[model samples]
Target: MTCRIWGRISSINVRKVVFTAQLLDLTFERVDAGAAFGIVRTPQYQQRNPNSLVPLLEDGDFTLWESNVIVRYLCARHPERGLYPPELQARFDAERWMDWQQTTLNPAGREAFIQLIRTPAEQRNAQALAASVAATQPLLAMLDARLASRRFMAGDTLTMADIPIACEMHRWWGLPLEHAQHPNLRRWYDSIRSLPAASGALDVPLS
Candidate 1:
C-alpha cells in the first residue's frame, strides 16, 4: 500500500514519522501541511486528525496520527527488518524508550528549541532557554549512561525505540547551545544518522 504523510520536515514530530518510514524502506509521499505550510487547519485535514497535527499517516484505508504510533505501525509492517523487536521483553523495552522520548526528552528540549531556533534573538527568553538546557542536560547524560553498555536503546540492533530518540538527538545536536559532550550517545547517534535511509529525515537543517 502506498503511504502518505502530511507534515513539514521542520517539525520534529513529522521528522520522527518520516525517519521511521524511510528507515523501514517504505515508499511514501510527504505533503507539507504544518507551520508556514498551512492545510492542517483545513476541514478535511481536521476530519482525519482532530488535533490538527502534522505527521498524519494514511496507509491504504488506514489513517493514523501521533508520530510515535505511526513509527510503530510502520515498523510492524516490516517484521524482517527487526526494527519492531518481536520478543515480549524487548518490545516493551523499546516501547518504554519511545514513550520516554516523547514525554521526557522532547519536552525537556522543546523550550530551548523554540527560544533559540524559532524565536527571534531579540524576543527570546533567556530564563526559559536556560531552564530548558538545565532540564535536558541530565537527560542527555542519562542517555549516555544508557548507551555506554549497548549500541542501541533496546539492545545491539536498532529498533523502534531508537527512531524517535535518534530524531531527538538530531534536533538537540543541531541547536546552537553549548552542550555537554555525550560520547556514548553521540556514538550511537552518529551510527544511526549515517544510515542511507536517514538522508532527508535526519539531515535536514533545523528551522
Candidate 2:
C-alpha cells in the first residue's frame, strides 16, 4: 500500500516530504490538509497528530509528523537509496544540516517570505523584513563556505540534509531581497534544483 502524506504543497515543510517521496521513488497519497485546504484542524487529523501540523506521514499503522523527522524516516526506510547514510558520522553530518535548516535558516528567512509574499506592500514591516534578510545571509554564507568543499550539503551526493535547506533556499531565493552573493551556495542550489524531485517541489511558484 502507498504511504499517506497529509499537507498542502505550497507549504515549505510539506515540500520537504514531497521532495523526499520523489527522491525515494515511493508511492504516496498526499491528502490536501492545512492552511487553505482546512483539514488539519479536524478531529481525525488532530488524532493522528496532536500538534496539528502538516506533512504528517502514515506508513501502514506508523504515523509521524515534524517535517524533518518525516524526511529522516523516509530516508531510513530506503537506506539503499543513499539519501541517509548508515555510517554514524555521515548520517549525523546530514542530520546536523537538516536541524540547522529548521532551527536557524527557516526562522531567519521566514519574515522575508511573510512580508514579501503573504503581506501586502503597505502592511509589511520593513524592520522585521530587513532583520530577517540580514539574519539569513550569514546562515547562507556558512552554507556557501561548506559547499565550497562539498558538492552537496553533507559531502557529495544528495542526502536528507539537502531537502529542508533546499526548500528554505527556495523560499529565500523567491523573495525580492538584495541577496548576499554567495556564489558557491548559488551553484549548489542550482545543482539541487536540477534534480527531478526539485523541479516539482522546490522550483514551483512560491505561494
Point out where model 2 deviates above 4 Å: none
Query: Which model scores highest in TM-score?
Result: 1
Candidate 1 contains a number of clashing pairs equal to 0
- List TM-score per model, in order: 0.98, 0.97
- Model 2: weakest 10-residue lDDT segment is 195-204
Clashes of each: 0, 0
Q: lDDT score of model 1?
A: 0.93
Q: Write the per-residue lDDT of candidate 1 for residues 1-207, one digit (tens) a residue.
A: 779999999998999998888888888999999889989999999999999998899999889999999999889889998899899999999999999999999999999999988999999999999999999999999999999999999999999999999999999999998878889999999999999989998999999
lDDT tens digits, residues 1-207, model 2? Answer: 799999988999999999999999989898989888898788999999999889899999999999999999999999999998889999999999999888888889898899999999999999998898888878888988999998999998988999998888888898876787899999999998887777679877888
Model 2 steric clash pairs: none
Cα-based lDDT at residue 114, candidate 1: 97
